[model samples]
Target: MKSLNKVLLGSATLLAAITLAACGKSSSDSTTSDSKTVSGTVKLWVDTTKVPYYKTIVKDFNKEYPDVKVTVTQSPNGSANAKTDVGKDPSKAADVFEVANDQLGSMANQGYINPLSPAATKAVKKNNVAVASEAVTWDGKMYGYPTSQQAQTLYYNKAKLSADDVKTWAGLTAKGVVATDFTNAYNFYPVFLSAGTYLYGKNGETLKGTDANTAAGVAAMTWFAQQKSNKGVMQTSNALNQLKSGNAAATLDGPWDSANIKKILGDDFAVAPYPTINVGGKDVQMQAFLGVGCFAVNSNTATKNQKAAATLAQYVTNKKSQLVVYKHSGAIPVDKAAQASSTVASDPVAKAVITMSQEGYSTIMPKMTQMATFWNLSAPLINGAYTGSIPAAQYQAKLDTFVSAISKAN
Candidate 1:
């Protein structure tokens, strides 16, 4: 994956150079004219589920750039596949598209997406949540306009767990109704992350092995094993459904579960940042992996269409459009103004997710391709620890093996 990424980067750099030279004009000059005189059809790709929100955004965008016709299409492959889909055929790529922040590195490295214009960068910094802004930035360059923030939060039944009761793992364990997917590394990662275990170093520029055998990692795994024995942790295929059926008082999950869970729990539904966990008699706050949803311009877009595409991207991510998205999809908006609005302010789930993204000790999901190997290597370790196949006493040895595997993979 690392070698392939380097080849993609080299090819993309050359393509960008050729495209720039062929235009025979500075980006600044093209941007100025493209912003006003440029009038052409611009294509946008969005998740099938989000097509309505994008349609609404396009309607509003057209009012401003009436001459720039915008067509919205659903990306059958989903946002994560945007880079490969675009790279396969630049002419077929949408002028602007929505993608998860982790895809930014691949898209930018492959030149599937364009770097943000100065104005777009400024808007991203000024209006977005800090982590959301940071997620879209690749190698010190901003690539996308952030739209929403994603992270796991503690969703609880207010009837069973009080606001304070959900604040700590020990407290929840005593209540004995909290459940989370113990087998999946993504869902259980907060344990190691909050304990200071990391999957990579140098801001994802390097794939350093984790410290899962350290005191922190062992403590986290021990706590998790205890939960499994007590039935407070679940490895079921239907964790969310179980939570919705009132099988558990609380569950750790991302905002994607909000709509369905909210329908089931209704007024009893509530969310809070991941609680502090007791590890070796010390309290450590659990941290979540953070992600951002954003829109990026296609590098293949015609010079006359770049500014229009950027304009539409900005318009959709702005406070007004984000509010519309929140209303339609229940996604936590990244725009500060939108987040501060009464609708999101009053939504406990939205507030909790935003807080986790900002105040919690959350780690941004690394964009490096090496992350693929980390996920594959970490899953068995997490599962083995949870099922007691890898006992606490043996955690150090297993961790050493895991690290060795990662090094070999690298």
Candidate 2:
């Protein structure tokens, strides 16, 4: 982790420099590093388990800007439910809340959060991983400060399978069993990406431009069907337990589970990027949806508190706070400096996730308003194909229907 004072200094400097109006301007009043002028009451929503650590971070935040009083509370639901919870009534939601990257587009479109000012955006871009900056941007504006990354990578037992063996799907399945769930779209939808199809188009912003209804899409579905017959591939909802019981040699998982995985595999634990799979007769790299967790300032926050809320959002997502989140929650840090620190660089799980976050390894999850519909429809579509219920002949038709349904305006 970087020095706390340095990170705080950066946060203080950015806070001092920002003069732009936030999403809602109730008053002509402005906030700066001047503790008295910036004083306001703001609420922060975080995961229940994170309340304690975050409160500690807020304590340090107050030392720099004492007049800004922060109330840290557990969100009504976890971060995964951020969109729905905030949507229920944005004005009632916390002033600053935690959210995942995928929900940003709809939230931004619906006017639930404020976009970062250009100065804040420039600061964020200069400090975090390149992918982190990319993940928080929806359309042309950045709506949140990225704090951590969430990408599923290959977690294996080195004693059972060599690193090279895990490099290709065929190589992995032939040597040992892999426990995974085809019902999970997050785990397998990127198979379409590997097959050379785009989700919401190349830049991932075009609402009607998702291109997954072609021969490439069918090839990806067919590859799923083949996995059903592969003895080395085990369909399981609980992969960690399978790995612990020796029923599977590896599984696809995100950093959230790295701590538990380490305890289960102990001396044999190893991690790697996704393997190349045989799709359309050629080996192509398997990709995962790259998710970045972030902190967003609500557009509905009281106008007088807008600056404080924005500052709090930036403060808690800085490198020091990010490291705290990583230490206490196992979220892979998105800060470039934090990542290069020995604590993170030395961790195999973090290294693999960071590598997987790069281009060609994963795709930034599209943040379209229609993405909610995508999640609801895609898992069943993917599962039906994987389980042979959708059938090989209907692969194209099913994909066509799936794409059309999610492409419609909300």
Candidate 3:
């Protein structure tokens, strides 16, 4: 349950290509005089899975600000581009929108959103991870308020492996555990991070490649391939079946899987960070794949509407609302104060994600424009090397081809 049930390279494709599919989740608020009635048609767009929980938070907010009557609406799942399309016109615009980190570049480039003022930016800066803020910033201006954040970590069944036993990928395999639908490209993320290899060069946002294709990267990829591909020790045909049927016991993933995992395993579930990798003769830390979801105000909203939207966004992202949102959605709260709450801080999985988010060098998932071009071939090529379909020496050439394909497409 802690592992994702499905792997959508397609979503990753959208992310890398700089095109977003839109979902129609909507929220509303109204203005008033007596008691400061907060009534207006506030528009919102979010995934369906989050709509119900979002409604609860909106309801609670309405209770506190009764004068502001609010409405909530659900969006079709996996349609981020459609949401962006509506944002083009005020008639169909959402007062506030939820854009995934991967799609931020496109959304920002289209000028559909407004940047946060210095005051609001400072507020978010005080509590949020610097990377989270940076992910939503473009051209040195902040445009979004992060609502939730996450990074990769290990989740295991306590009944199956001791935390100490589940610390490393090798250990997890020893316990007869494996990843759920993880491609070699995805699985190697931890090792690359631990090795301090990033997909793009951090200097001036240049993406010319890095040591991620190095011997260390290949070694790590080969190790995982041996477990899942060669040794037959790890389950290859969907790791979730292994978890659901008790065939597998440990896996790596993020908070997105928490709620379902809780339902499947109950209290037997345990969480830990990725096992350390060797770097420079030292035990390096786990590399986490970090991403975030944020709220942005429309650039076209009137100054009055913009101010009100900003206020509403801040209120919803505040500690109490974050608690409600995280509890219901299984999302990592963006507020530092919320991270300290017993409910969040006590969870080992949440803790591991936070630990990684804090120390981990967060990177942008490729903007949508490059996804399919890079990943469609990248995953296959990387998997081929690990599975012995391609020679190890050819790794750099294969990677170069994929990168060239995607870069040219972009």
Candidate 4:
């Protein structure tokens, strides 16, 4: 791993040399001239698991820009901690780093990452899915190139319930065998979303909590309350163990669980979009919070290296590189062409997620800092609702309080 001192020293030395050369030149003139001859050692941070795929991408990138070299480093914690790591020192941060979409807003707010250059922005728009593209945009500016799309899907035991039987919450509950961590806001959020509840207003750009007091919100809460009595719904610590032991017919989860679930269920393991839930006697398809993986540039990198950093970011997210990532890791490709390819279309999990993305049934996880408060306030409410501590009659009031608290905090 490169130390912060080395990173800062390299950037300072490079910037000082560039400064002397452009002493009499305008910033715009310097930028234009540098773009044509952009060449430098771009430090790239990739998830430890994806380092091999990125190494392959670097090899391919070298074919187009032989003068530029990319140094790939493995980030043990993956993109989840990228914001904090980069924030510690933007000048010392990796020139290019992979991050989850939810980090974009915080990173941009803190000046840790740069806005995408015009060419980079255009490439992202043209190649990636709309939701993936939208997830990387913060305050109307594109910050990163999307690499993959991630969202939870229904993983079930085919022998216990047919595909049709798992389409609705009522139908699945009737089978008397379902398991999920009800306390987890992420796992249970679909119940509220299916009933048209939202965590924020203005398409998640603002932090006005859901109208939990509304008829829709109350109805959703009522249904969640009923789950407590559903003997079929296990409340164990290891829900996956319940499925593995044949005690549960299905579980709500994501692609990351696919490998282990498949190992346990073999040919019986299957995945589909979340089932519809009954809200006020009406069936609505559950909506999942979508997460996107992306690559962003360090805003404080040497000016001469910014264009090269953008080039490298764009290169790794292109269709070809996306296909490589899909092959190595089971991550769903955000590139339209790569997603449409037979390789992706043939995979059941990838196909189901792609369908959900195309149909616009998923919500992008909000990247705003206010989300921290939303999660904190909503978790207790969800737990209370599930355990019957928060009665159905008080669901509205509780939701209202939650919204007010978060609004005030934000």
Which candidate has the top score in TM-score?
A: 2
Model 4 — which ten-residue stretch has the worst lDDT? 4-13
> For residues 1-410, what per-residue lDDT tens digits would candidate 1 score against the true structure?
21112111000000010111112112331132232443566899988878877788788767766888999998757776677677788777888887777778866666576566554566578776677778888888877778887777888888988888888887876774876666667777667877777666536445564556678777777876776677555567676777777788888777877788888788888888888887667788888777777877776678766666666676777788877877887778887778778988998888788778864457777777656666777777777877888887888887777766665433
Q: What is candidate 3's CA lDDT for residue 87?
A: 48
lDDT of 4 by residue, 109-218 (tens): 77676565444565568766777778888888777778888777888888878888888877887874888876777666656777777766646677655565578777
Whole-model alpha-carbon lDDT for candidate 1: 0.70
Instruction: State the lDDT of candidate 3 residue by residue for 1-410, as single tens digits.
Output: 11111111000000000111122112222111222333444566656667787778777666655544455555433324433554457445666666665555555556565556555666678876566677666656666677777676777788988877766555666665655544545554445556555564552134464445665655544543454352424636465557778877766667777666766677787777777654534466657556666766655554444444545565666777778877776677767778788998887767877776765533455444454354566567645755667676666666556546654525
Which ten residues in a row are the worst by lDDT in model 3? Answer: 8-17
Tell me how candidate 2 scores on lDDT.
0.83
Which of 2 and 4 is ahead in TM-score?
2
- The list of candidate 1 runs beyond 4 A from truth reads 1-35, 404-410
- The candidate, 2 or 3, that scores higher on lDDT is 2
Off by over 4 Å in 3: 1-40, 63-69, 78-91, 184-187, 209-225, 228-237, 278-284, 302-304, 361-372
All candidates in order of TM-score, best leading: 2, 4, 1, 3
Model 4 TM-score, 2 decimals: 0.88
Better model by TM-score: candidate 1 vs candidate 4:
4
Worst 10-residue lDDT window, candidate 1: 8-17
CA deviation > 4 Å runs, candidate 2: 1-14, 17-37
